[model samples]
Target: MTSLLEGLEFEHCDAAAARSIRDTVEDIYRRSYVQAIASGDPFDSPSEFMRRFDSYTDPRNRGFAYVIARVDGKPAGQIWGWSLPENARWWTGLNLDIGDDLEEFTAEDGTRTFGLSEIMVCTEYAGRGVARALHDELLGSRTELRATLLVEADNERAYQRYRAWGWHRIGWLRPGWPDAPKFDVLIRDLDLAVNEK
Candidate 1:
């Protein structure tokens, strides 16, 4: 909540039918990640991004949620995630050495452990508190017991911010996707004081 974000508006959308807002969401994604897309990475292609989004929004997907933030009447950022099913493959690609404790992190029925798929703000609005506002607005009402997100290993700035925000680095994972990179997985308890605000 900074002065720059004072005029921002947030909207929650039904994950299964987000088409009405897809254009605005993709616009923010394209503008915010222009550099990555310019590198000719197939994973960053608009179509590829949409394909993943399509799957995440399927009605059969449990605990799915999507949120958008608009600034000056234009999409400035978005955040979305879904609860991890008991058999979710999220841990299959993990490269961490957690041993038997692995079960401790796996989701089960009624566990409400969500996987934070994406969160980003347009580059022009970086550091203006838009990202935080979007994050807070999305998580504040979540009934999940905990949430997880992955940060690129080299993204020192974001990793630091997540850490400072009370997220703990649990392990690493390399997803089976085109041009995917190993990521440091971070977990944050929904009961954390900051998130409770």
Candidate 2:
């Protein structure tokens, strides 16, 4: 008997390296979201996804870190994110009712926060812990005060997984894209996480 994780390997990349391997990343994403794409939503299409990937790979997104998981030499999953600039508009459309001032919480000087952009594991690799491995590799070395990510509000499974992994929802956000559904804004304090560990 062989454990799925026994053959797993991880690769870390910067923005330039990530750009160079865009095709592989895109392939993994497509395989991971096959069902979503099958729904006929333009936002879930490969082309639209590439557009977002391009932005994430842009040099302007400083501290961009990408991690890929491989099982038996084949791509299995990926996770990536970057530091948010002071003027970042990531919080613009967030609707928060949590008593805390959103501005103060979101204040960024390119070091205060890390904006996690994407994380996905191919269907064949799901439940094999590849996604969690990629996540830990990418975020474990971050020096930011906290990290934030968006998950589709209705995705109960994913939302619950994130919650169990220490992320808590602070608000809801509807992206500027046409027909974009609302997503829950989840955040995790890196310092606290480290301390608790």
Candidate 3:
């Protein structure tokens, strides 16, 4: 489907291609997250941000995807994610209890779920549907039964957007990383009628 935002274009790139355009992605990140950076947020640190991207697109990675959105042929936003592996520790920090069948329920049979890691829209493009375009295109193309993403617990705007996008909050998680803050873990079931339309 065509992006709703006029003059917007979405292009898919693999992990290597994403790494090649790291600077462009970082530029969008810096602009979209200027407020967080000014607030002394460690996750906004340039080095830390780059490290997070590197971890997502590591050389040994087996599954990953990236989409860069352009407005009038200029980069305006980006989104990317990867399939969760059997060894994935993304849920390790979840402060919730699971019954004895936790392992059986959470086992990754290779394409069970996708983990959406990042989405950023340039400040200049805010409120122009760039983010919704990028986000929908990325998630809609995924084959997994469901998708997951973590957003700051207090980000009301983000929470509203996700909720409006048909995502449901599963629980809260505090990443083990020293600089990471408590985040809400949201899940979007791909098999639902809400996403099918």
Candidate 4:
């Protein structure tokens, strides 16, 4: 499996670069979530995905980073995230009470929390380390104290992968989006020492 990933190439893009490659990113997203889209899930539709993508890549979103991975010069995967602003509504729909302190974690400054919005690998590259590579490449040097993301509760594969990647469930959230499914809110502390290096 490791050998299969030898040709993988990764590119880091800022908000402007992300906008320039909007179509390519959307294509990768659709390919990555082919199954979910086929299931007729409204939330998984291309239009909906682009809606979220636009928000993530918006210039106003501080510290936005998008990483794309390719193999043999073809797009294989992508991962992106941005810092949440002070008093962000990211935790608004939490179904579980994780305490006021935890809820207030993002209240001080926008840089305190990094919100990982999306990470996906094409089906053909699923079992390889493409996803992990994209993930690490994007967050390994982040200056944020912590990072958080939401994953569908029923996505066992991704949930388990996240667990293996050092994330722990903090609570559940059903986003404000119409017909959105409940997602497991996971958080992981980021080691700032990495950025110091």
* Best lDDT among the predictions, by candidate number: 2
TM-score of each: 0.91, 0.93, 0.90, 0.91
Residue pairs of candidate 2 with colliding backbone atoms = none
lDDT tens digits, residue span 8-84, model 3: 87899989999999999888888888888788877778778888888889977677899999878888889999888
Best by TM-score: 2
lDDT of 3 at 185: 86
Q: What local lDDT score does residue 79 receive in model 2, on the 0 to 100 scale? A: 90
What TM-score does model 1 achieve against the real structure? Answer: 0.91
Which candidate, 2 or 4, has the higher lDDT? 2
For candidate 1, write residues 96-188 as lDDT tens digits: 556645666574664567788898899988888887787778777678788889889798877887787778888889887667778888888
Note the Cα lDDT for every prediction shown.
0.79, 0.85, 0.82, 0.84
Error of 1 at 152 (Å): 1.0
For candidate 2, lDDT tens digit of each residue in 2-40? 487778888889999999999998999998999999999
lDDT score, candidate 2, position 128 = 76
RMSD of each: 1.9, 1.8, 2.6, 2.4
